[model samples]
Target chain A: MAIIEIEGLAKSYRVYQKKEGLRASIRGLFRRQYRTVEAVRGIDLTVEQGEFVAFLGPNGAGKTTTLKLLSGVITPTAGEARVLGHLPWKRENAYRRRFALVMGQKNQLWWDLPAAESFRLHQQIYRIEPSRFERSRDELTSLLGVRHLLSQPVRELSLGERMKMELIAALLHSPDVLFLDEPTIGLDVIAQYNIQSFLRHYQELRKITILLTSHYMKDVAALCRRVVIIAAGRIIYNGSLSGIINRYGGQKVVSLQFIDGRIPADLARFGEVILEEPPRAKIRVDRRVVPEVLSGILAGYSVEDVSVEDPPLEAVIAEIFSRNGEPPEHQVGQIPELLKEE
Target chain B: MSEHPSYLRVLLTFARNSLVRDMTFRGNFLIDAFSSMSWVFMNLGFYVLIFEYTPMLGAGTGWGKYEFFVFLATTLIINSLVQTFFMTNADEFGELIRTGSLDFALLKPIDTQFLVSLNRIEWSSLGNFAVGLLLLAYALGKIDYSPGPAQLVLYPVYVLCGVAILYSLMIALAATSVWLGRNQTLYDFWFYITNFSRYPMEIYRGPFGTPLRRVFTFLIPVLIVVNVPARMLVRPLDPRAPEDFLLPIFAILATIGSLAASRWVFGRALLSYRSASS
Candidate 1:
């Protein structure tokens, strides 16, 4: 079920240009020209019920802006957004009751108060009946392993613990759709994995829809199979995360190991000498060419071991981001073993 | 599951947590409390010295020592309380709008104002209230004034109304943050208005004093809060009550209007908002 629908969604922000010197500051006070920045360009998207979609982008790439528009924190300058058939920006009480948004850079928790107090306040805000709130509160606290954190004030909690409590508070109302903007940011590897696992389980149990925007590829890799990549405020790619990998940069890395140093020419004939360490060398090949390259490398040299891998998502994303629309294949020769993997 | 705190319990917990958090700055709290006490004594020293010059200004509407000090102490107490509780996020509210930090409060399904206002409780300011009451009692003892029942009954109402009027005016002034992008100087504006409000308007040029008196009485209700009650304590009740006794009704209406306007401006600002993405 496609519970969330967005069509031709666009948002623009007004920014005043300032001159470099003190003169401009003085002049701006009297006379100023403002420009409209298209934060989220025309975007059309549909999210199915229970779908965990990663909305990925760089800074100012409109990822957070899109979430804000979707969550009703800010209104879009143009287009329409309906969450479960309710206009988000209109902020109808019913619509607000149905969705939750959590931003990593900002906290919703009362900084000085214990998480438990915040939870009870949330219950009153949502007008939750006591029994249901208790059940949900207990379920989230135990699941997040934050039961012990209930009595301690939020300011005393560690960053990981606070982020956990943030999630619990956001979910206390059991919102049907969750919009998370970089929720795993600044968490350690273990915390990230735990949160990701918990989200997956929580989503499955409640069948809630989730749309998350994160700069962390691991967050996307672990949680979202489908991704929507927005850059410069436009949706450049949308499909499976692997599809974006393939579309942007689909070559694979082939690393070769030997007992010691190796000649460049010996391995050069099979594939590009992308990396050269003491006894190890790396070559990249298209997935289509992996078999032939592997065989040729095996036939030509005394190879210790070989491994093929797709490039890190960050590297691939950086390449795509810096290109301003240039295809990744042109840079593949320079970006060693960088498989725009699907 | 059954052990979740009740709603009242939650608010108390929130206030307690704020107290605990402020306790970490215990040194600062002591310094602040001492600073407040010192300020009151200094102001009282002048009030005492005024007796050396003469008994009273004796001009019409000129308050004697008791009425004057009581009014001054009452306004200071109300001002400190508002600054402590209601204006906790006076500085942060602008940043909240600028950075979209307010979005979290909006999402909470709670009254955004209540959450933002109570988010930080300045526990040290309770000292100011204690000292304020002590001064009021001292003045009352000197004047041989005793408020039988009704006059005392209206004291809380006046003080609370004063705080509400002050809160609304601050909100209206802070609304400029939505457009100006900053309001660091707004507290000075609020403080100045309160300064003008504390002393009765009778000691002014007619041109200035009339408008000031009208503004405090009808529009903002600053005069009605402490001055009216303090006057009621010193002066006998008339068969016909002064027009200022009804000032709270007007202030309540204006507060509602100003709060609505602030919310409207906030809504408009949200459209132009670009969260600190740069």
Candidate 2:
């Protein structure tokens, strides 16, 4: 049932080193220097059928490259990748018809034409039956609430509306697998939530396997249960969202409210106090000792209310990315040291 | 869907999409059509004035006003067809690579070459194409020429052969964008090569012209694109005439060779393409 199976899939690019000034530019005409950049360094992953997985990374962390490899937009520099039992790079018509790749910065819709025209074009490209294509188009456009804008030119639509149209165009063919690379980028919060919910509904209704790369933690939290975190061209963490919080996430926030409106002087004994007021205080503590610290604080102080929560996902991910040379003790379970450092 | 759509149907969809896109800006479409047609008219007027002072082109090359105009019209037709179908797409191919839109193109089920080559159609070029046909008719009338069965039959075949050669050349040039990253020089090279095919091949028969003629005739084979089609019409096929079978033979060979060469270059370029990152 593994819809996607990738083993050591990698992509490397040879980039030219261009110096400044006119002289260097002129000299480049005769000879140039190049360095190989390993964009995606030997990644292995698998996603079962109908699973919605989030691929998270900072800028230039190879999230997009891995998506391209799976979508067959670019061939792997080394190793193999299979989606629905098809080698992506082969790019057989059969494989292409069953999947769609949508990029946030790049548009697949024609700028001057209406989204309706693009939908019809996709129908032909994927050879979707007329009745079935119409049904899928109607369902997707209605779900995305973009039916009213179908006749307008794509350039005229707002960023969010245009993205909805793009989603409709991509789904008109009823693809079996969807590879979305930052589809919600640049949209406002409401727009992002709309897209997130729509994706969740579509995945549930169609049961299609999806792999999405996003910088927004809200997108992952709202739509995907499984999260794969890549840093420096390698997957440093791959597990559930809460698992990341438990593994690499060392700290938690504990807020307390005293009934007598008095601060505890010995609160520092329990954890590092981040904020303090007359009636309330916020402390940061290791997640492992959160229970003991909570019990001690409640037992010592006259507290009226209390809460325990993990740190924000963005902070946790940032810590993982910045811990490039740090000790491996923060890693959960076991990721070979070599894979962790790559 | 039961089976993949036929290529012809997909091509029609591309054409329809392009047409809808063109229609979106009616004013721009008109301006583009009118301006391009005016440029062709100015070129025709300049050539008409040049023929007024000269009895024949290139001193006994037998290219008189009517015959040279026929050659010019043939060049116009081939150039218009290429510009209409392929030039803009080839020119913007670099932008596609730069912006990563080529990723969507590669993800499609269709042949990448077919999709990229015919993705956009410049409907404005139809004005030039129509003018080319009128010019061809006018030149044929001036020469008092009536085509025989063979001339009428072979003319369109050679024209298609010419288009195939030009398409091959342009595709090969554009495919280099994959390796060069952004090849603005492709337009320069395309212009320089196609410019060579605009005139009659007989003009390049002298001492200095011989080498240029050989290079364009055999190596690039652009000389035959316009010359063969126009010649087959002006001078009907005569078995007694020297090189009488040249058009039939060279047209086939050039078409096949250019197409094969372009395919190889495109395949190799795809191998070297480092697609743009998100």
DockQ, each predicted model: 0.26, 0.73
User: Chain B, model 2, TM-score against the native?
Assistant: 0.95
Q: How accurately is candidate 1 docked according to DockQ? A: 0.26
**What would the per-residue lDDT of candidate 1 be over residues B190-266, giving only the tens digit for each residue?**
77777767776556447877887887766665666566556666662334355445644555565566566656665
DockQ of 2: 0.73
> Which CAPRI tier for candidate 2?
medium
Clashing pairs in 2: none
State which docking tier applies to candidate 1. acceptable
Residue-pair clashes per candidate? 4, 0
Leading candidate by DockQ = 2
Misplaced by over 4 Å in model 1 are A112-114, A127-138, A250-271, A276-282, A285-315, A325-342, B1-13, B23-27, B137-150, B214-221, B236-274
Total clashing pairs in model 2: 0
When summed lDDT is taken over every stretch of 10 residues in candidate 2 chain B, the lowest stretch is B235-244
